[model samples]
Structures are given as structure tokens and as C-alpha cells.
Target: MKELMKGNEAFAEAAIRAGCRFFAGYPITPQSEVLEYLSRRMPEVGGVFIQSESELAGISMVYGAAAAGFRAMTSSSGPGYSLLQEGISYIASAELPCVVMDVMRYGSGLGDIFTGQSDYWQAVYNGGHGDYRTIVYAPSSVQEMADLTVMAFGKAEERRNPVTILSDASISQMMAPVELPAMACHDPDAPAWALKGKGNGHFKRHTSVMYYMNEYDGYVRAKYEKIEKEDQRWESLETEDAEIVLVAYGISSRICEEAMRSARAQGRRVGLIRPISLYPYPVNAFDGLAPRAFLSVEMSALGQMARDVALACGMRAPVYSMLGGTRLYSCSDVEARIGEILGAAHGAF
Candidate 1:
């Protein structure tokens, strides 16, 4: 059965279904609903939910709960997400499993509560001080909010690292029908490294000291390599013999798809590549493609994802950007940009 749900609430409900027994987070616009939903739902499921005094405190609580072998999660928007960096670094260093969500809002320093995709660099590049990487998922729809939240918890445990759901204000607040996953239970004693009480003297857990070990470098390298090789995910549309391919994710990709369809209807060879995973970056999606140009569509003024597209395709062709700084542009706007790029390629002005 599908229920009409908002993206934030869907994500929260899905977390509980995925066995997320502990949640700690502060209220922030565009994502506060996540905390609110979990607060009421957690106790009903016999789980724990805490509305921490601050984002820092919330993430710290998540770290402690995750270390105890429980499925834990936290969420916030840009500013609050910034505060979790230190705790996220600590969790990464400890190799603990947890999930985090960034309901991105616009701007750099205290950007307004408008929709934005400007956090691409921060989330993918690890804003915290560390030699670490967190898996990032960019969802374009409300259904994905539910689906990916469930997958994130599993992936976090699988990799023993934090996984991030990178959503924008549009997706977070939009209402759509979603068929959520079934409820699952997680055992707190499942992980060998969990901090059990004194009765378990044989197994001890140490965190944030991996750098001191001789093999730390090799271990970290291998882990990320495997993830990069096997975890890259994307959705390619009509790229078989396309001369132009548009790359985007989240709400931006939704608009790009519309543009691609419009361009194709007019007999233009346009395609789209929607990245599902942002960190590994879905570089494999570019394999065996030889388009004349690549266009990066984003909601940031700087075209933050354009560079990654260039790197993935090895600059085989020119990469263009259709940027929407603080708001979404129409499909016709994207089509106009494509026209400009095509005209420039043909030296038509």
C-alpha cells in the first residue's frame, strides 16, 4: 500500500523500518520534519529519539549509539550539517556505522532557507578534517527518500562508515505517494566491535587511533578503492548515440530530464545521466560514451558538479553548465542553454 507522504517524513519512517533504533538531531528548516516525525515514531517502535540542544550534541549522541551496535541516524540542513563535521570525522575514524541526511539549503555562510545544491563539494569532499570518505546518495523524488533511507542504513553497516542522503528543500517538503519498506529489527549485539558492558572482557574497541597503526594507510586505501569500484551508481537515458549528454542529480536532474525529452522531440541528440551516488560519482556511467559535449545541470551558481563530470569523462569533450543559483529553472530554460551550446559548437554565434 502506498501512502501520501512528504519526503522528510518518508525518510524518517523508512529509517525506523530499516531498524534505525536510535536517532538524535536538532531542528533545522527543510529537515526539521524528519526530527519531528522520528520523535513521535521512535517511542512507538521501542526505539530512542532525542531532540538534542545542538547539531553537535545530536551527532555525538549518534556516535555513542552507533558504537553500541545500534542502527543510528541524524539529519539537518546546511548550517546544522556543518556542525556535524567533527563528529562525522570521529565516527569515520572509528569505523562506526551510521547514517546522516543533509537537506541542503542555499548559500555559503549562513545561506537562507531556500533550496540549493551548493553543498556538493562539502558532502562529497568531506568537510571535516580527515582522510575519509562517506557514501552519498542523491535522491530526486519523494519515493527515493523512503527507498534510499532504507538502503543507507544497510550500506553504513556493510561499509562500517557513515552514509549520507543528500536531499534538497524541494524534495524534503514535497508530498508524494510512497510504498515504504517493511519493518526490520536490528540486534544491538550483532557487531563484534560493539561496546558491550564489562561482562565482555575479551573484546575491546578502540576508535580514532587508526592513524597510529602501521597498516592504517593501506587499510583505508583498500576500503575506498573497493567502494569506488563496486558502489558507483547512475541512471543513463538515451545516450546510445547522443551528441550531447546532460549530467545532473537530485531535483536538478528532474528538470534536466524534461529538457532532454524536449530536445529529443525537436530531433536533437540529447541525453541525460542522473547520478545516484555522488561520492564514487558514478564514473562508470560514462564508460564507452563518446558524446560531442557534456552539460552539467545544477542548482548552484558555480556548477559544482561540472568538474566531476569533466574528470569522469576525462575531458573527452567540452563540458557546459546550466546553473540555477537559488531556484529551479524551467525545462525551456535548459533547452535554450542547450541551443546556445550547440550553436557555439557550430560557430553560429
Candidate 2:
């Protein structure tokens, strides 16, 4: 049904609909509503909901649930997500199918409960240890929170890898109209590798990454390469004939969308590339936009995404970064930044 729903609530409903039978999480701001909503709804739907003592414990529980061949998930913010890193790495190593949602908040250590994009690097690149990547989704709106979450689960299960929904306080707390999908039933058939009890008359084999190190490394690399080729997702706007392009993701993409409209109206040639899959990172988005200056806008003190843009563009164009920190950019702010970059380039002319 169509209704005005908070992003957290929308995502919780989506998880349920996506056949997420197990939810394990610790409450953290900007995302606490997800846990709270799931807590009340899970029991009604015959699902397991666990309020773990700590973020570490919560992700550990998710790991166990996922290993059992169930659609499992967890949610948290910055520091809490930091605590889940080891478990995430283990999940990656074991190639477990699961979903993790991070409603990003500010700071290195409990900076603030406010929204921030500082976690982009952590979400897309260094989620955990030992050269692995998860399918990361950046949702800009409440509706996308629901939609991409369903996609996240599907992708994780399809690839037998973990997927992350990397949102922020703005997207997590914002309310917007959304249509909930019909709930799907969770399947209980254990995978060939899943442990079955002794009485079940099956060989109970446990999942682990302890094998030939070289072979394991090669296997992981091959899997990631296939994901990179097939899973890169992005939206390009006005880039076919433009001098300046703005690259962004998550909520910043929404702001840039507005800015693009305004800039086009004002006769300033500005385009945009919004990355929906941050891990695979739409490098193709930068394929032909050479001889143009690029602006990477993000909500961080340093432009973590700009680094990726530079690499994707092959250092052919000058890439600039605008760090918004915890503050969201107004359309005017984006236009002004575009003007600054364009004007500076013109001055060089």
C-alpha cells in the first residue's frame, strides 16, 4: 500500500518482504527505528528478532544466522558499524549471504548522531579486512531505502556474498511516500554446505575459509571481477555534451539532481553521475567525459569519493572535491560550487 513512511520503517518492511527471517542488531541513532520497527513486526510474521548486547554480538548473531542458509540482516551506525568489522570480514571470508544496513552518522569516535557521508570509504572499500568487497547500495530517498534493500538481499543471495545498504541520518530519518511490496516466504532448505543435525541423516559440514591460501585468494579475485563487470550501476545526467560533471551518491546525489536542473536552466553546462552501487563504483560513468573538470561532492571533511572519481577518469581531467561534512548542501551551494569551478577554469582561459 502507498503511504508516507519513514526511511527506517520502509527499509524494515522491505527486509521482511525480501524474506529476511533473521534480524540481529543493536540500537543506534539514525537507524534505531529500523530495529524498533522490526522488533514489533517480526514476531507477528514468524521471524526472529534479536536485540544483541553489543554491535559485535549483533553481527555475530547475523553471521550465524546467515551461515544457517537463512536470509539474515543487521543495522547500525558509525561506531557500532566499526565494531562489526571483524564479523563482517569473517562473513565475507565464509561467503555468507546476508544484508547489512548502515545509517551513517558523523565522526571518528561517536562524533555526533548527525548525518554524514564519512563512512563511504568504510562502506565501499575497507568494510573489513583481507581484500574483499561487498555489494554496497547508496539510497538517496526513503523510497529507495525500501527498494534497494530488497535488491541488496537478492544480490547477496545471487552471489553468495554480503551486501550493504549505506545510508545516512538524512535518508534514514526522512519520511516519504512508498509502496510496500507483498511479503515473501523465507525458504528453510539448507545449502549443501550448511550444517544439519545428526538425526537429520545428512553430513553436517561447517563453512570456513581455512583452505589452500593461494587457491582461496584466486577464487575470491575471480568472484569480485565478475561482480565488477556485471554489477556496476550508475545514473548519468546531461553528460553527453557538457563541460563540467558533478559526481555524487546517496543524499548528495539528490542535491546534485536539483543543482543540475538549476544549472541547466541558468545556462551553465553541469552534468551528474550518481553511483547506486558504490563498491563496483560505476567507473564506466567516467568513460568519455574527458577534457572536463569534475566536482566530487560529499558529506565528509575529505572527499573520499573524489579519489575514486580520479581513478575512474584515469586522471585525464582535474577532479575537485566539496566536503559538506554533517551539513547537507543547498541547491544554491551546489550551483555556487559549480560556478567556482567553471569560473576558475574560464579564468585559466
Clashing residue pairs, backbone N/CA/C < 3 A, model 2: none
Off by over 4 Å in 1: 209-212
TM-score for each of the candidates: 0.97, 0.95
lDDT for residue 271 in candidate 2, whole number 0-100: 90
- What's the lDDT for residue 268 in model 1? 94
lDDT of each: 0.92, 0.86
lDDT of 2 by residue, 79-141 (tens): 999888888888887878889999998878878988889998888886577877888999888
What tens digits encode model 1's per-residue C-alpha lDDT throughout 1-349?
Answer: 9999999999999999999999999998989999889889999999999999999999999999998999999999999999999999999999999999999999988898989999999899998997999999999999998999999998998998999999999899999999999998889998876887759467566588585688988989999999999999889999878889999999899999999999999999999999999988999999999988999999999989999999999999999888988667889999999989988887872
Q: How close is candidate 1 to the true structure, as a TM-score?
A: 0.97
